[model samples]
Target chain A: MPAVAFTVVIALLANADIAFGQPPGGRPRPNLPPIPPKGDTTHTLTRDFVPASNTKSETAPHDNGFIQRWLALEPIRKEIQRNNILTETYIRTAFAENNFSTDFNVVPKNGRKVKVGDQRLQWHALDSKTFIFNLYNFTYAINKPPYGNIFWLVTVINCPEEIPNVRMAAGVNSGGMFWLNGEEALVLSGDRDMVVDNVVSQPLTLKKGKNIVRAAIINGPGMCTFAVRFLDENGSPVKNFTISYE
Target chain B: MKPTILTSLSILVMLATQTSAQIGQPFIHDPSTIVECDGKYYTFGTGGGGLISEDGWKWHGGAVRPGGGAAPDAMKIGDRYLVAYGATGGSSNHKGAIFTMWNKTLDPNSPDFKYSEPILVATSDGYEECDAIDPGLMLDPTTGKLWMSYGTYFGYSRMVELDPKTGGLAPGAEPVDVAIACEATAPAYHDGWYYLFATHGSCCDGPNSTYNIVVGRSKNVTGPFIDNVGRSMLEGGGKLVAATEGRLIGPGHFGRIIVEPGIEKMSLHYEADLDQGGRSVLAIRPLLWKNGWPVAGENIKAGTYVIQSERRGYALELAVDMVRMPVARWFNRSTDEPIKPVDTQKLEDVIGDWPSGNIDARIGDYMSRPHQKWNITPAPDSSGYLGAPYYKIVIEGTNRALAATADGKVITVPEFTGAPEQLWMIDQLTDGTYRIMPKQVPNSNEKLALISFGDSTPALGKFDVNSDNSKWSFRAP
Candidate 1:
């Protein structure tokens, strides 16, 4: 029994050594950079990245709700979804938690209606200027995976106005994505060989003090998993703020 | 009869020797005249006037003239020693001119030890009665130049250059405002660091006078110096140093360091009177240099004490209360689950002592044990508290106003009030528990005892005795 246990211990150590020696398998392995020294700010310095053209996923699912319906039915919808699937969740959660109906007119420019499920989620031409909405979630979760009981989400914030400098941090099992005002500000994806910073977003400089901020979160499915929080540069939650779906 | 006379003369000689040795050794009144010449020591301040110390500990009293100045700031240049005396002033231009006097030698036996007339270096130019109160001298090693600093108003201070030989201001040299306080007073210097030490808020008035010490530094002798946050000295920017924790009142008018070489100890002399109305007694405290700044003796015990004359080493201890979140409760998502507050006052293993005791101890004399253990741990959940570490211990020094520091931090109680003295010499009982007692007490009949931690959750095991020195122990309150 002692010899068997010793053999098992050796095997576990050998496995751990091999895992530590190489990067994880998945997407093409990019050039792995060295970790920065403690307190050194040079490595992994933050910057913004954005692309103009829409890049569609080669193998996207066909039954992914209204976004899927729009992609299958409308040529313009296909172009939009092909470009960014991250934005759908933001619009969906904003309407669902705010008790917004999908029956409202969405295209104020053309008087067109965009329907979600049986209701139209849109802004009317007459009420576009005064239209407002709110969102609240009873369940929130962001956690690491394998044994992850929560969700890992990726998001993008689209705003007409410039954002102010804010402290932004997110914790999750794998990683997430982010875009600010049409610009890709952060991309934290997949597991790496070593432990990494759970917070992957940088403190973004926004306009003076107040501005619009939108985040599109994509959470990996799991047991009892789902959550996203908006925080300021001081790592404080931006609470009681309003959100609009249209 | 002649034989009897001879015997009497013999006895007189021995008595004179003993008296000379013991004169300036005891605490003297203000109007101090002090000189550190060669190796001998001579000092006079407030009322007890002239006193001399050879070894810098034992003092023998000297003469106090009818009137001269409050107290003299002394320095030696080449062959002569110059002492700056505080006078009301001369012409209206410089009303606070602290007059300077020349003395060939500080030795009483020297024939050339004659005092000279005053040399007016500073005078008042304002109606607020700018008085040249506390004066400090510093020398620039790069150019071998001399500089002088003086206080004005309640919190304003300025500095200028004096000719090394003449002991007078350099021609065309103007006194620059080194720093200002909402209530700043005394200033001093060590190494190349010009320490603009001052007190803020109300002072001197009993019980009501809030006083505390704040300090800033500058690289240039004529400073546009800055504080920890880079705020300018002239702009009233400074970090706090010494302040009255509890009974310790108005600790200002700091004297130069009485450094005893070969003994890693530096003693800073200052003045403190009970409620500002009592007589000003010379207070001495052992000094610590942290990152090139002077921190007065730490772990001060609270209570009444006669400050020791010799230099003593004080351990450096800093406590910052941080908010801690429990792992189990942090992830608990039930909104209705009442948020529980953390118990911050559990001091069991932490052990450190603060210098405490009467006016003597607070003033840098003999250190005591009570003020040493006067710990202030965190007390959270107060809507009234905000910023950095929310809780704090407020203080008032001799000539400065009242101020406070972060929570869970201990302060040196600056006065000798007969309150519940927190100074103690803690001893571990046989059962592994500890009890504290005062370092020294005048009344032998007065039995000393340790106060309980109150109904607040028991936190006695948070502090432990550091292995290096038993004189100081880490304590949590």
Candidate 2:
């Protein structure tokens, strides 16, 4: 091993199996090692990272545990996307009034019914997952989110091992709601920054294989994207995972 | 007094202001016409008010505009400033009315700050095919008439002519359909080609917005503006100007600032900057004309760079004999040991090996050698060509500088003298390559073109028009 790799190993050993946030089943919390406050840029780039603390940050207050590739869906709400006659303020107002529960986690299993924006949707056999929704609008303009509007994308994660007492680490911009295995997980509403590992979810169970992850992302007429990864109980990345699109 | 953080910060801010006049502060949306009245620059935005810049940078909001609407355009018409905007348009307000007013001066402190009452120019009474919003103004150079283009994504984008003297509608002027398929249609005249620029795709969604500026040009100001590919603006045919790919997205409402003749910059509102919490902020980029069409270029930033020749991507270096530095390997070096910093090859180690004469320029494989790097610093006080500051390109960490010679050759001088030959003008081409031209050579009127003189030799000659051999790209090691 090179000196850089050796130093990284030593740092990992020094931080191994440390107990994190409280969770059921005594599983360690899935969280990231805290970085020093924003000013010390030099030290922050070093391998010996300090553990996280609950420092109040207006942009990224909380740290996410894991960040990995995810799939997204084409945006819905044709009424809003039509020449933008429905207007972004109208969709933003509806999202502000907390009216997006109807869009989250439409269908985890293939052939399940999901109702969204006066339309009933179900997972088709051809539905697939993508790496990210960063270019969903341009890549899928047919049903992509138009300017000044809102849309939803849901992804399914298939984990090999059951990740007990784990937290869903996500970086979401412009606010969104998350669901796991058809259960409501967290709601990050309001116009917020999408800092990496920005939000940590409450204790959740990632069963062996085929876990449904759904997101109803809302943008007030700008860029909207979400990054997510699974964290194991021991403040580390959960390995052996793939995603599904059905 | 000892230098503290506050004092050092103050010095940094002062230095920054003197270097770049049109950057580094004031995030705004839908900015109005940027005009220099006295020594200060002023612009009105949406939301009824405006911002004032004392030194062309570091803006603060104190000025005001009438109508309190969105996407306002202000023009200096003779002795007064003509301002136009949409009154009730908010994406889908077809009932919105176009309004205009006049003010003598933009400064609120000026005695001539009073604005005339808002006069209705046009209106879309909620039932028309177009929603009257997002207006842009232009003064026809040939006809000396004022024209405004206004509409929304609701339907047709239309243009109407006005009398320049009174800012009133011209006789027999009706709304003529100019462009469709986009919003924020702005008209401009350049070299007999009347250009129409419009913002395409989604806006207001922060990072998700995909706003880009597209353009079409015409020989006449009014009808049938066409793109380079011969697509009409009325038929959704537009050539792209600025689009998303980098950190900023949804650039809309094109504004032009003329920095002397042949030099210009374009201003627009990026719907969301991913780094700035998705807030709509102002952005100004270098606007250069290529093939008779205006294209945006990158802002020059101070940095160290590995100047690479565009043809073969070989790095530029001092024409000196190569001495391979010995690489030492320690048998006892263990992986468990902490890493130590290694000293980079210094200039002194190679300076003695170089010929004691005028050093020429060459292209070679990058070896992180001291001769392969250059430092580019913005020379703002000294004037160069249009719309850009002259730059001083010096050998990294050394006094040896690159200069263009009278005989169409490049040589490294011992020190920078701020001479015309030592000043380099860099402009980015539409394909993102930078063409660097020296200020002047003894009797030549062309730029320094870097070309291959055999296999590995890089020689300089007069620039060949639209030649790839003349462009270079910078890669930082």
Top candidate when judged by DockQ against the true structure: 2
TM-score of chain B of each: 0.52, 0.68
> Model 2 segments beyond 4 Å from truth?
A1-246, B1-25, B306-348, B351-372, B377-394, B397-477
Q: Rate the local accuracy (lDDT) of all candidates.
A: 0.36, 0.60
Q: Model 1, which residues run further than 4 Å from truth?
A: A1-246, B1-34, B38-40, B46-48, B58-60, B63-67, B89-94, B107-110, B127-130, B182-192, B206-209, B245-247, B258-278, B298-477
lDDT of 2 by residue, B1-477 (tens): 001222223322322122122333345556765777766777766544566676454555655765555667778889788888766434321356677888888777888789887777777654344556678889987778788887755446888997777777788888988875466788888888889888766554445555678889988778798887675776455788898747787788887776544447677877666675555566666777888888877755778899887777788889887778877676778889888777778888887787765799888888888889899887645453333467888888876778888877778888888888888877655456776777777577765655555436666665554666766788785
Estimated TM-score per prediction? 0.38, 0.50
Evaluate every candidate with DockQ and list the scores: 0.00, 0.02
Worst 10 residues of 2 chain A by lDDT: A18-27
Q: Model 2 residue B310 lDDT?
A: 75
